[model samples]
Target: MVSRVLVPMDDSETAGRALRYALDVHSDAEITVYHVVGSPSMMMGSAVGLALEDDIETAATERAKPVFDRAHEVAAEYDTEIETQVGLGHPTRAIVARADDYDAIVMGCHGEHSENITRGFLVGNVAKTVFERSPIPVTTVR
Candidate 1:
């Protein structure tokens, strides 16, 4: 029996679907919605900006607010409350690092950037990496 579920959320349709799936299937479990900011990029703009902030944690949380808000709305639809977490650095690494604390992980097969031509036919890089590397069971929702 899974008592703790981690749902990684982004501003994507599939992410919402994943959250819904987790809530519906793990009704008796504690659900936590996680959002990652400052993920590495070729330009490193967001990550660098966050690093420059005096309060990096606060900046990251503020950056993740919109996603967390959407997750809250979804939880409301389920009539359940969920905890929210913010993480810094690479999405895949951050998720994997947190995996040991949960019984399972549920996430979108792809993310907002899946529309990129290069990634159009593949799972989002972060999701794919986490799926492969996470220590706990992972379920991906499309």
Candidate 2:
């Protein structure tokens, strides 16, 4: 009876797998593939030194499109509507706030990052922070 499911991903391999899992398991459900961009204000006072908030948001959306497109392609057999949502703010807060809109929250067990960026679930701060305050069930992928 889960009519809607949200899959928040940075469009990485593991996330791709999670998206695949959702589509395969819940073909009849509506799926929202989401990506969160850290607020420009948060980018400020940080080491990233990325000043182009607008540019980042644009690029992020464009980048996320392909990921969702792939999901759409794979979900063709099912009745799934794949969408790309770009959230501007903290990742966990945005996700938690929107969690109730969907029947469930499905996401990668481990987040996605660049080759140079370190990646791990509980070992990293992103996963840790989300773990501390996730209101819904979170299934972490390996």
Model 2: lDDT of residue 83: 68
Residue lDDT tens for model 2, 26-138: 77888888877666663444314334545766765665576667667756756556866877667778888777787777776566553137643243345445556676665
RMSD per candidate (Å) reads: 1.9, 3.8
Worst 10 residues of 2 by lDDT: 42-51
Given candidate 1, what's the lDDT at residue 138?
94
Instruction: Report, for every candidate in turn, its global Cα lDDT versus the true structure.
Output: 0.89, 0.67
> Which candidate should be chosen as best, given TM-score against the real structure?
1
Residue pairs in collision within model 2 = 109-140, 109-141
Residue 125, model 1, lDDT: 78
What C-alpha lDDT, on a 0 to 100 scale, does residue 22 get in candidate 2?
Answer: 83
TM-score for each model:
0.91, 0.71
Error of 1 at 102 (Å): 0.4
By summed lDDT, the worst window of 10 consecutive residues in model 1 runs over 113-122
Tell me the lDDT of model 1 at 19: 96
Please write out the lDDT profile of model 1 over residues 32-136, one tens digit for every residue.
Answer: 999989653457866777756778888889989999999999999989999999998878888999999999999998887674543555577778899989889
